[model samples]
Structures are given as structure tokens and as C-alpha cells.
Target: MTVNDKLQADWEPKSDAVQRDQRAAYDEMRERCPVAYSDFLEWSVFRHEDIVRVLMDPDTFSNAASRHLSVPDGMDPPEHTEYRRMIVQYFQPERVDAFEPQCREIAAKRLQSLLGRDELEFIGDFAHWFAVRIQSASLGWPLEMCEPLRLWTQKNHQATFAQDRPAMAEIAKEFEGYVHELLQIRRAAGAQASDDITGSLLRQYVQGRPLRDEEIVSIVRNWTVGEVGTISAALGILVHYLAQHPDLQQQLRTQPSLLPAAIDEILRIYGPLVSNRRITTRPVEIGGRKIAAGERISLIWISANRDGRVFEDPEAYRLDRDPTANLLYGAGIHVCPGAPLARMEMRVAMEEILGHTTRIDPIPERPPTGAVYPGSGFATLPLRVR
Candidate 1:
């Protein structure tokens, strides 16, 4: 019944299989051993309750699990809180509202451009393109920079997940150069009269001192590396599901007020984030298992979303499900601060697409390839726009 007992039971593949199929694998583990450990990746906390507990108590399950990938966002409370507050205001409702119309316009233009095409790959043609452009514009980056940034971000992620050290070093050098150039430009221009997110990050300070150059680089890298691909993946999932369920789509079209709830449901059903690992600072008991200090603990968000104990009809997607129970945006203090921005983008996108097209359906005989971690989702989601 304990974690050790479960570890003795059997070993499961955490990474080999494609993520979509891994849900069932995680569920099986949750039932047998919620706090499962592997020699390769430390312990995997699979249950909703267990993952939530760890998220809430950062002292016990420290966030400084790993340094390279875990940014300030992944650090523990006092430290995490400071970094978060530095820019939380930029994602406030008013700021999000200001960006909403722009987001809607972007979605409309993208949809218009691809309208009437025989087939359209939503991931590249729509999702990646829209997400990168919006992110670039939001931060006051040059419009021309979006494409190159997108390419770099993709390569950066690929190299990291692949664990290719040489490639990572090369890409990091390139990224450092890019951020350095941007920093110089901002320094020369002084503070502008605009409220752009990047400008705020540049002008903002912590503890009465400006954020260091490397800190700025880390922040921008995390934003692009963390957000863009996930948003694209989420978009692909949304389009895939919507295409499969014409009735639900029709209902949402008729009851457009349901768009927000529908988006929440879609994210809950197939959220972009997969799992994140944290290290134990001391021995802790979880799901009747004893996890020793210094062991890696993976909080599988995607698995928790499909947890049958917490969700009714866990496999089925229901738009009206209560949002309180969802783990899609994560939990505790480390929960995604960019959630409001992501929601705004998603809502505006769906609203625009539905307004212009009679129906959005999937193209049969062509399924997109799954992304490996640090990224996942459709390589090419060719959908019928009409």
C-alpha cells in the first residue's frame, strides 16, 4: 500500500510512450501506487490529492528540483512570490482587456487568410503563427522578430528535451546574443510612454534594483520557451476535439456565452502542460508511500486532470464542469500567472473562428505527429475550416 511497496510492484514507462496514450498508464499506477518511484526519474506522484498536497506545501517538497529548466517560477515561496509580483500586474484584467480586441483581430485575420483552403494545418498555419505574433506584439518586440524567435524557441526546446548538450550550448549562445541586442536597444531608448509587457519588465525593479541582464534573458526565454509551443499544442487539442464533436460545437455556437466555460473544459480535458518534477527536502509520506529527501517527484498535471476520483466521467469532456476542481493551470502559489492572458487568447480565438466559419472539423486520413516533451501536440493538424 506504501510507495516502496508500489515500486516493488512494477515499473512503468514514463517517457517512452506518446503522452496521449500515457493517461491510461498513469491511471493504472495511481490505482496501484499513487506515489510511484523509478530509478531513472525519481518518484511520480500521480493522484490528484497527492500532487495537490505537494504543490501546497513547498517547504516539504522543494521547487528547486532542478536548476536549468526550473526558472524563478519554479522556485519556492518567498523567492517565487517576489518574481511573480514583479510582473503580475501586466496580466491584470484591465491589461488583458486591452489586449483582447487585438487578440480577436489577430485570430480573425489568421482565420480569414486560411479560409476556403482545401486543407489547413492548424498547428503551424494558425496556432504557432498566432501565438508567436501575439507574444511578440504583447511584449513590444519587433513584428519581424516573431518568426526568428519562433524558430529559435522550437530549436531550443528540441535540443533541451533531446538532451543534446552541444546543440543546447549553440542555441543558448544564439539566444544570449539576441537578448543582449534587445537589452542594448532598450537602454538607449530610455522608458517609452507605452505599457508594453517587455517595456515593463525592462523598467521594473525588484528590491530597489533593476533586474540583471541575465534575469531579463531568463524571463524572456522562459516566456517564449514555456508558453508558445504549449499554446500551439492546446490549440491543436481544442481543434481536434471540436472537430470530433459537432454537436457540442453546435451547442456552443448557439450558446456563445458558453465559450469561456467550453474553453475551460477543453483545457481540463487536454491541457498543454504535462508533468513537472520537484525534489523532496525531507522524508515525506504521500499516498501511503514514503519519499525520502533529495528524491525527484514528478507532479503529472495531465494525469491528474483525468483522475477518476476527482472528475465525473473523467474520460468524457463536459463544458459545464465546475472550474474549481481542475488542475489544468496547476495549483498552489506556483500556479501559472499567465493564465489570464492564455484564457483571453483562447476565448478570443474560439469566438473569432466560430463567428467566421459554420463548422470546424478534422480532416480524416491525416493525423498530426505527437511532440516529445518540453513540447507535445500536433505537428500538423489539418482541419476542415468550412
Candidate 2:
């Protein structure tokens, strides 16, 4: 069927029901209608098999769903290939290794601030701050930019959830302004520019030419948004999950070596990222649903990761599951380039958190508040730590 013919809504993405508990809602959608249609998301592919198919076939399921330029994330091959080459170098093993100390220091310091409190809101007191500080430190941004970046991330999430195109554009422009000023300072410094990620971006070349200022801004914006939002959510999810499962928490705390695999398993059970967008380049059929060319598609990462078809007893945490099958960082050519950095950051954060505290318990009187659409994990996670 063509786009015009399939006009009925299969789900309400913004309804309180779905927003209140997205994981459960998505799981329902995956089983009932794997390739479902909605006005807000256009077409949401909710199953692992279908999402994997789209990820593998980028030519047919193009990532150029956004009207705005999104550096490598919103670009398809040839263009995506070239820019990805330049981008990947920033997150190389050596670069990530060098940043490990700084990442841990930030995490340690943030955890110290929350230690005295008997009950704390983990998201505000620690998770968001760690995300902002580490991202700034990683990119050589001024510490003063932390608050603005945090507020900007919040506003960006609100704008995205509302699907406010104008607001999103204005927010993007605001981010561009911040990046442009940073670039200008570096340019003025000439040879004295700080030898950091942002400064080095000024020297990067793409297709035999230096990257444009706007392109640099786009790349930085993408990284900042990705790093801040997802890391914060992941931390909250990891902590909240551990608080509920004290046995698992104690096990991980006792054997810190199990954290890498444990963290991945927990996040797979509860995804940090909600979804990613794609556009159909040609007529395609997924899960017996027909979709036409030029239609927008949402690859529901949260749902795909929890699909029982691929993950047996999908909600149960299992460390032995095939790591490659877990779509935590995604798969195929456009998989997250910063996965290594993100993993390192999370592991360090957890290590410091678990090591510093003897126990982490959820405040039963003040239950955690789940973040709404476009955002995942707990928005207000109250935990008692000691």
C-alpha cells in the first residue's frame, strides 16, 4: 500500500500511557504490531529482526530523515563514509585511553558531592552533572559552559518531545552560536590553541578540504547531545536497576570486573536511547506492513533490544547472552562511533559509585519518575546511598 492509503494510526506515541512506561508500551507494540504506524513517528519498526534489516540496508532505509544537517548521523554513504572517517579518529583507543583518568576524576568528584546526603536525586545531583562535566572535559570546553549545556540539553529534549520544529531550529542555532564562539577563540589563538578535541576539529580535513565551521558545529552538537543525553539516561537506568536488584548490585560491587558485561545487560533490559530515525528510499514491506518511498521511519531501539524473538526471556538480565546480538551501541556501518568512550565512562562511573558506597537503595516513599518520550530512564531517581 502507498503512503496515502495507509493513513490510520496504529499507536499514540505521546499518550500518557506510553510516556509513563515506554518500555512496556513498546514491548506491547513489538508483539502486536512490529511495524506500526503513528502520526508522530510516521512508521515505527519495533522488532529486532526488522530494525536489524533496516540497519544493514542503509541505502533503502536512509538516515537522512532530518531536514537539518547532522554530520555523520544524518548522512548516508559516500558522504557518511568520508565524515565518519574524520569523526572516528576523535574517539580512537589512544584518545579514549588518555581521557580515562579525566573521566574517572569527574565521576569521583561528582560522587563525592552526593555522599553526605542520606537521600539524593541521582539524576540531578550526579548523572546529569557527570554527563555535562565529562563531555566538556573531553572536548576542552570551558567549565562555565556546563550549566548552559545542561539547560540546553533539557530544552532540546523538550523541543524534541513536542516535535516543535521551530523551537528545535532555534535551539540548534543557539548551540551553533556556542560552538562558533569556541572556534573563533581557537582560530585567534592560532598555534596556541589548546591541544584538545575541539581544537583538533579545526584541523580536520574531509574530502581533501578543511571542514567548514558549520560542519564542525554540527559535529560537536551531535557529540554533545549524544554524550550528555544518553550517558545521563544510562547512568540513571544503571543505578536505578541496581538499587532495585541489591543482590546483583552487591555482586557487581564485589566483582568490579563483571561490570562491563553487567552494564550492557542491564541497559539491554532497559535501553537508554528510545529510538533513531530513518527514511524509506523505496517501497518496502516490514512485518507484513507496506510502506512507500519518502516515508519517515523510527527504529525503536528500546523495543528492538527487548524483543523476545532475539533475546529469550527478553526482560531477564543475562550476562552470557551474545554481546554482538545486543544492539546497545547498534549495528552496521552507522553504529555509534563513541561506543568505546561511552562504555569507558559508564564503567568508571559505576566503579567509583559502587566502590565508594557500601549500599544503594531506592527510596520507597519517593518512587522514581520516568522520563517522557524523546528521553529515557528516570527523570527523578531518589536513592539512599551510604
Candidate 3:
């Protein structure tokens, strides 16, 4: 397909689609524009191998300043390494284990509340709400703060797709102001930091000194804002898929032991976090295309995860698929720090949903994922439950 054809398809979802099926269009782009460049959006890398190479070789395709629109995860190593190390423990296995009961409780409570509703917007009601609350509580933030933070995060995300820098800047300022207040309160109260992730960060002494207020702000921004939306979006897509394939849902429900595997399969099939941007620090050739220094390259994770080069049946969802090779959480040094936690939340959420309900079906009339990145899903997913 032509570039305009691809752009048209990609941009189409912003208006017409559910935000979950952008993969077909992106897969087409990977074949057509493996190293495609846009004067407006820099380079776009679509091939699975090429994306892997970039993700693995952070020194060349540096993430130092390419994560999101800011400089936290965008900063490259060894600084990024330090920051990652300092907070990495927060999402470690044991830490995630500690939050399990809370995750299940939140999911169970939400499911209970929705018990008899004929229809519900799963994204707004359960997926987004539960993930936001779980993440907030995990970080020691008051559950009451979830709505405000959710609003700010949505505004910040919407601003990214905005064409004006001034508008994005204004949103950034607002986000910073709110985070700043939270940081101050947490510090002044000299509150005994709870044994959770946020508390761990607060008590952490990076480089042998207490983390600075600005540093704390950066960590929380990266944690809270960067996290919730993707998980919610992914959960919405997973739920929709499970609803459509009742047999698969049955398989999962019958063998709850299969959930972890099933979650990985679902993620591989419909990874919520779509693309990550990387800048070329040096000229390089990838997938037979020359990429010059300073150009932006989007590591199309959603496309890569679905590439036939890696997955045997790239488009099919198989619960039996081994997840070690999947790029859903990405690969290499800059891989997502919160992946373990996300997985934990998803497993618990799905378990609760499956345990409480027998079957789920997509409404007959629904939108498709056309061109948006990370595929927004389910404006509303109404399911019939027991």
C-alpha cells in the first residue's frame, strides 16, 4: 500500500474504530516502511527484527530522551540505569506478590458492583477504574486521588496527539503542579512510608542521599501517568477478545491454572502499548534501510509482536504460546519496569471476571481498530454474567 493509504488507515481509527485493531494497518506499514521516515514524526521502524535490534541495542537507538514526550525514561544510560536500579525493586517479584490480595480485592469488588447490570462500559467502569485504583493504592496514594490523576493523565495523553506545543506545555505544567503538591505533602508529614512501591521510593536514598523533590516528582509521573492508561486499554482489548471467543474464556475458566499463560497469549496478541520512540545517536542501517543520526524511530511493538518472522502463527491467539519470546513487555535494557506488576494485575482481574461470570459477548455493532497506536478498545463492552 502507498504511504497515503497507510496514513489514511492509521489515522482512520482516531475517528471510526474501537482502537484495538490497528495491528493490520501497522503490519502493512512494517512491510512497506520498515525504516520509513516522516518529516513530521521522524522514523518509523516496523519490522519485528529491526524493532528488536533497536530495543536490544539501547546505546545506538537510545531511550534516554525518547520515552513519552519528556525526559524521565527518555534519559539514556548510565543515568537511566541508575534511576531504573533505584526503583526497580519496587516492581520485583516479592513486591508484586505483596500486592496480590489488593489487586484481587479491587477486581472482585468492581465485579461485584457490576453483577446485575445488563450493559456496562467495561473500560470506564472496571478496566480503567480498577487498574487506576490498584496502581494508586500500590503507590500509597489515596484511592480518592485516582479520578483526578486519571483526568490529568487523559489530558496529558490527549495533548500528545495535539498539534500544538503550547497546549502540551500547558498540560505538562498542570501535571507537574499537581505532582509537586503530592510530593510536598508526603514529605512534610514525615509519614512513615508504607511498605509499598511509593513508600519504597520515598525512603530510597539514591546515590546515598534522599531523592530530591524534583526527582520524586519525575518517578511518580513516570509511574502513575505512564502506567494506568496502557493497562486499561489492554484490559479492555483482552476482555473484548475473551468475550468474542467464549471457548477460550471457557478454557481459562476451567483451568485457572492456565491464566498466566493465557494472559501472555492475550498480551502477545493485543499488546496495549503500541509504539516506543527512539532517536538514532549514530547513523545505522536496519532492515536494509539507512537511518541517519538524530532521526526519531518508532519501535512499533504492536506490529513487531505480531510479525510472522517471530510468531509461528502471527495473527492467531493461542493460549499455549510460550511468552518468553514475546515483545509485549519489550526486550533488553530499556524493557518496561512495571511489566511484572501489570501482569499481576491482569491475571487477578481476569481471574475475578472469569470466576464471577460464565460468558461474555461483544455487542453486535462495534467499531474496529483502524489506525491509532496502542489501539483504544471498547467504548463499551457489555457482557452477560451469571
Q: lDDT of each model, Cα atoms only?
A: 0.77, 0.93, 0.73
* Tens-place lDDT digits, model 1, residues 143-251: 8898788898789877866778899989987887887887777777776534566656777787779887777877877777667877787888887878889998888
Candidate 3 lDDT, 108-197, residue by residue in tens = 988999978876667778877886898788877777788887787677666665545788777767767876776666667676535555
Per-residue lDDT of 283 in model 3: 81
* Steric clash pairs (candidate 1): 3-289
- Descending-TM-score candidate ranking: 2, 1, 3
Better of 1 and 2 by lDDT: 2
Q: Quote the positional error of residue 194 for candidate 1 in Å.
A: 6.0
Per model, state how many residue pairs clash: 1, 0, 7
What is the lDDT, from 0 to 100, of the residue 219 in candidate 3? 76
- The runs of at least 3 residues in candidate 1 whose Cα sits more than 4 Å from the true structure, single-residue gaps closed, are 1-20, 69-71, 191-195
Deviation of model 1 at 31, angstroms: 2.9
Residue 99 shift from truth in candidate 2, angstroms: 0.4
Residue 87 in model 3: lDDT: 73
Better structure of 1 and 3 per lDDT: 1
Off by over 4 Å in 3: 1-21, 66-72, 191-196, 319-322, 366-371
RMSD of each: 3.0, 1.1, 4.0
TM-score for each model: 0.91, 0.98, 0.89
For model 3, which pairs clash? Answer: 10-371, 19-375, 19-376, 64-74, 64-75, 64-76, 65-74
